[model samples]
Target: MNIIEDLRARDLINQMTDDEGLENHLNESRVTLYCGFDPTADSLHIGHLLPILMLKRFQEAGHRPIALVGGGTGLIGDPSGRNEERQLNEENVVQEWVKNIEDQLSRFIDFTDDQKGAKVVNNYDWLSKMSIIDLLRDVGKHFSVNYMLAKDSVESRIENGISYTEFTYMLLQSLDFLRLNQEEDVSLQIGGSDQWGNITAGLELIRRTSQEGEEVKAYGLTVPLITKADGSKFGKTAGGAIWLDEKKTSPYEFYQFWVNADDRDVVKFLKSFTFLPLEEIDELAKEVEERPEQRVAQRRLAEEMTKMVHGEEALNQAQRITHALFNGDIKELTKEEVEVGFKDVPTFELEESEKGLIDLLVEANISSSKRQAREDISNGAIYINDERQQDLKYFIDENDRIDDAFTIIRRGKKKYFLIKHV
Candidate 1:
């Protein structure tokens, strides 16, 4: 199947400017398309995953994909999906974020000088050089006040009162499209559902600026905004957004995010996220229907995502940490693995080289008091490194430490506490 067909199968296509025309354009030649990412934060999160993957999909299908980092428009945030004006960041901070996001985008898109190799461009290059007169006379003239006001992005924020800076964000984005179309021969722009207005505005600018009788091939497409089966926001948890950077969210935590996908959402997530064949996904969908308790689909989803975002070794490490935790074999994990596996668990730092088991338990508050500590030990409820230690006189020492750094103390069946050897 064609790339568009595959996207349709995954329900990735939320809105397309011209369905038939875009498909014909894709089939006719090696189409160059782009998706813009405004660096609002230090790292791109899971919320940005779909569009990045969309670019990769086009690249694999022998099309050039340009990953545009909005170093310029980022200064004046796009008010597309926001309810209020975004606080502008300092130029230096935005530049740092742009570099970080650029490095992250490089990991997904192949930049080697191949036939369909991808390119990363920063709009700041040209936008910064253009004077205000040039912007108003050349670009801004194409967009009328009524046309801009009719946009959902501007209209939505009309009552809240958008600033002139933000109100003109659409014009800036349109200028990006026109510039890329002229310089790089870009014919398509893609983004999330919220960006439909900006994408089409760019198309309008391209149409207005083209020579009379010129047939503009520029088109816009957007992917659906992901939703959860439970109606909670996607890409968020109690901890916060699931970041693409491993330092922000460890591979173990990232893996667990997909592994914990709801049964109702797992199949849809598999379709949207994974490059797994539809036939294979269909089989996984059947497993979701027949033996969901096994969680076969969820595990596969986690595997695909973890491997894609993090490398194979990171995926293995996450899986190893997960396995060690699930099998109650904490002793098998390394100090780093233990850190990632039990990162959210209660922790206590030991100042001394050794401490009596009862005192340690009470000191760490794993047990309410000394009496409860002894009672828990005597009742065979206390375990050190997954080994039941009923000895009331037992002392936690270097031997109990994993890599001489961490000691996993299980108070009961599942409540675990990490004792750190300082």
Candidate 2:
């Protein structure tokens, strides 16, 4: 199947300009397509995944993909989804983010030098070199005040207020397209649905710059905003954005995010996030319907996404922790794994002298008082490192610490407390 049809089957296309024209462009010759990523933060989050995966989809279909890192335009943030002016990052900060995002993007596309292989390009290469006069005289001529004001990005923000730096973002993005079109023979641009205006502006610039009557070979496409069934935004939790960086969010935590997908949303996520075949996805949908309790589809989606983002080794560790948690078998995990696995759990420092179990419970606030602590132990509801500890006088020792790092204390069935050693 062609790229458009494959994306169509997955319900990924939110909007496209001239569907037939783009399809013809793809069939007639090899097309180079690009998706811009502005390094607004140190790591790209789950919101960035759709475009990243789309680039890979085209590359796999034998087309050249350009992963455009917005080192230049990132200085002026895109106002596509924001309601107010963005706080611009320092050049050095954006530069550092550029490097980090570039590294993460490299893992997704084939960068091997070849016709269909992907290449990472920075807009700063051209955007940074142009002087203020160069920008005003060259790019500023193509766009009129009326044309700029008509775009949704600018129109919506005109009431609240917008900086000229942000107002000029579309023109800068359009210039990136023009430059890439001239240099790489690039013909397509893709982004989230919100980028439709900027993408079209690029196409218009390419058309006008090509001679008086020549056709603009380029086109644009966008994927829908991933939504949640519960009317909440996807990729958000009590913590924050599900960052792609392992340092910001551990592989264990990342895997758990997908593993806990809402039953109503799991099927849609499978289609958008995974490269699994349509038939396989349909089958997984059936599994979701047949045995919702088993959460078969959630497991498959988590496994696929975690493997793609974090690789096999990290995925294995995540699964081991997950299994150990469910089966009360956490003793097998190493100290480092324990730290990553329970990074957010309630924790207390274990004093060397104050190691008695009853005193520990009261100090850690796991029990209301000494009375409750004794009752909990007698009722066989307390566990440490997955082992029952009924003896109220049981003194915590180094042996209880996993690899001499930390100890897990369970109060009742689900409440867990982490005691860290000095």
Q: What lDDT does model 1 reach?
A: 0.94
Q: Which 10 successive residues of model 1 have the least lDDT summed?
A: 110-119
Tens-place lDDT per residue, model 2, 1-422, is 89888999989999999989988888887789999999999999989999999999988898899999999999989999899888889999999999999999998988877755679989988999999898888788888889989999999999999899999999999999999999898999999999999999998888877987776788999999999988978889889989999999899889999989988999899999999998998898998899989999999999999999999999999999999899988888888899998888899997684398998899999888999999999999899998998998898888898888889999888889999987
Q: Score residue 45 of candidate 1 by CA lDDT.
A: 100
TM-score of 1: 0.97
* Candidate 1 ranges with C-alpha deviation above 4 Å: 114-116
What global local distance difference test value does model 2 have? 0.91
RMSD to the hidden true structure, all candidates: 1.3, 1.5
Residue by residue across 295-330, what tens digits does model 1's lDDT show? 999999999999999989999999999998888778
The candidate that achieves the highest lDDT relative to the unseen native structure: 1
The 10 consecutive residues of candidate 2 with the worst lDDT sum are 109-118
**Residue 59 displacement in candidate 2 (angstroms):** 0.3
